[model samples]
Target: MTILIALLSGLVFGVAFGFLLEKSRVFEPGVVVAQMQLRNFILIKVWFSAIVTILIVVTLLRELGIVTLHPKPVLLIGDLVGGLLIGTGMTLAGGCPAMIMAQIGAGYRDAWFVVLGGLAGLAAYLTLELLLRPLPADGPGPLTLAGLSGTPFPALAVAVGVGLFACVIALERLRPWRLDLGAQADGIHHDRPGSPRRP
Candidate 1:
């Protein structure tokens, strides 16, 4: 009933959000590159805004009994390693694994290889985990951001918001936004967004 409604709502919202991301020029190569270059601000703004809103909303929900904050202990070694790998791959590939998905749906054929590679990587990892057991990291739980810091939820949320706000302001000063020019009119960027550089 309510759970089903909420799940449906989340799916609907995600689809709507993907469509909006496509429309907003947020998923462009120039945008990602600028973020890497420390030039673009919109991507920073959106992500920061999302984090801020989620932290505040989740904290409130937990307080109201609408949500629970059940978190497992953090494993910094694995997290740091995973982040480094994901970041390095994203930097080299010009697209994060998640964005690779959006690219695929938008008709970019090159994304097929990336997706395949990702599948292979996952399969390899699973095979290794089955053999090694605790060789890498063992986890039987979920981790939340607030759990790692041990700060009050409201304070953590505020801290995150302030930090993200600072980042947004800093990136905005770089003026990374580019005009669409005639690209939209031609329906080229409208399909496989950002720039034509990404595969």
Candidate 2:
């Protein structure tokens, strides 16, 4: 019963997440590619905002004893390799896993290929897991910033969330979201320098 409830909760949250992503237009191929090329700030803004919000929510849940924090083992080598692979794939596909799903939901035909490629990659990784040994035997035990810094989890979460939220605000101010949208309210492409100002 608990498992079934958890699954239903996940379904609800997943739908909400996808709806938000679609509305934000961050799942668009152009937007994703622009972000990878550092030509747009919308993706980073959304990413940081999500991170900060999650951190705060999780901290509150922990304080209320509604959830427990379980840090994963710090496998530096595995993380580096996985990050490189995921980053390369995302750059090539112009969408990460989550973004690709949203793209498909938004009626993008090309996103299907990206999804297949991701599954192929996963299959390849599983087949080569033994030979590649990406997960080494030795890794730093599950460690959290709070544990490392000898601070309470709630305090660390608050500090980190505040810092990231500040960054999000600064980014929005420096490069307004409308600039990255590629088209202004007047339907003019004035993102480039020397372009006619929006009326």
Candidate 3:
């Protein structure tokens, strides 16, 4: 019963997350590619906003004893390699895993190929897991900023969340998101003649 409840809760949150992503239109291929090229700020804005929100929620849950925090042991080499691979794939596909799902929901025909490619990558990783085992060991044990800094988790969470939220606001002020969307409000490039192109 507990497992079922947890599954249902996860399902609800997943739907809500997808709905928010769709409403923000950050899952659009143009926006994703623009972000990869550093041509826009919408993707970062959404990411920082989500990070702040999750930090606050998780902190509150921990304080109320509703959830426990578990930091994973650091595996520097594996993390670096995995991040590089995923980043490269995202740049090529113009969408990350979550965004790909949202893209499919938004009627993008190309997202199917991204999904297949991800599956192929997963298979490759599984096959290489044994050979990569030696490089996976990196750190002594689990670590967290709070533990390293000798601060309470709640305090650290609040400080980090507030700082990120401020950054989100600043980003919005610097680049009004509408400008990132072409004049037609679509993701495609539609620069006008004599208009200055942003670097």
Candidate 4:
């Protein structure tokens, strides 16, 4: 019964996430690339909001004893290097793993190429495992500000969430999107690359 509940919850969350991605229009190649180039702030706003939201929710669940916190030990060097590679690939491909799926759902035939490239990269990583031998075996594990400062996780999460929210608001005020909800009516339109204007 627990397993079934988990599966159902995953399905519901997955659909909701995809819906949000599509509605945000971040699936558009131009919009994704624009975020990478820092000409637009929508994607960052969404990313930070999602992260903070999850953090806060999970923290609450933990506090309520509904969920236990079990963070995995992370290899600092490995994660840093891997993150750089993934970021570079996303910049070149104009979409990340989740965004690629959203793009395909939006009838972007080009997203197939990105998917193929991702598969190829995964294959290469598995085959070239020996090349990653230099990754540090022992490194600092998860070190959140709460852990470092001896603050409660809920308090830290709430503070981080508030800071991120303020940043998003400031960004929106500074460089507002030209077309808000009206952009959706126009289809998946996007402005030229590097321009501050957006769909």
Taking all chains together, the TM-score of candidate 4 against the true structure is: 0.80
Candidate 1 error regions (>4 Å): 1-14, 136-150, 174-199
**Per-residue lDDT over 1-199 for candidate 4, one digit per residue giving the tens place of the 0 to 100 score:** 5999999999899889889998776666667776777766667777887887887889889889999777666778887887898888888888888888888887889889988988898899889888777675667776666788999888887888889889888888887764422355322334546646652
Scored by Cα lDDT, where does model 3 land? 0.84
Model 4 bad stretches (over 4 Å): 1-12, 178-199
> What's the distance in Å from true for residue 98, model 3?
1.3
What TM-score do all the candidates reach, one by one? Answer: 0.71, 0.84, 0.85, 0.80
What candidate 3 gets wrong by more than 4 Å, as runs, is: 1-12, 184-186, 192-199
Stronger candidate by TM-score (3 vs 4): 3
TM-score order of candidates, top first: 3, 2, 4, 1
**Each model's RMSD to truth, in Å?**
5.7, 4.0, 3.6, 3.9
Best by TM-score: 3
In candidate 1, what residue range of length 10 has the lowest lDDT sum?
179-188
| RMSD in angstroms between candidate 2 and the native structure over all alpha carbons | 4.0
> What is the C-alpha local distance difference test score of candidate 1?
0.65
TM-score of 1: 0.71
- Cα lDDT tens digits for candidate 2, 146-197: 8899998888888888888898888888889887787532213565788777
**Model 1 alpha-carbon miss at residue 196, Å:** 14
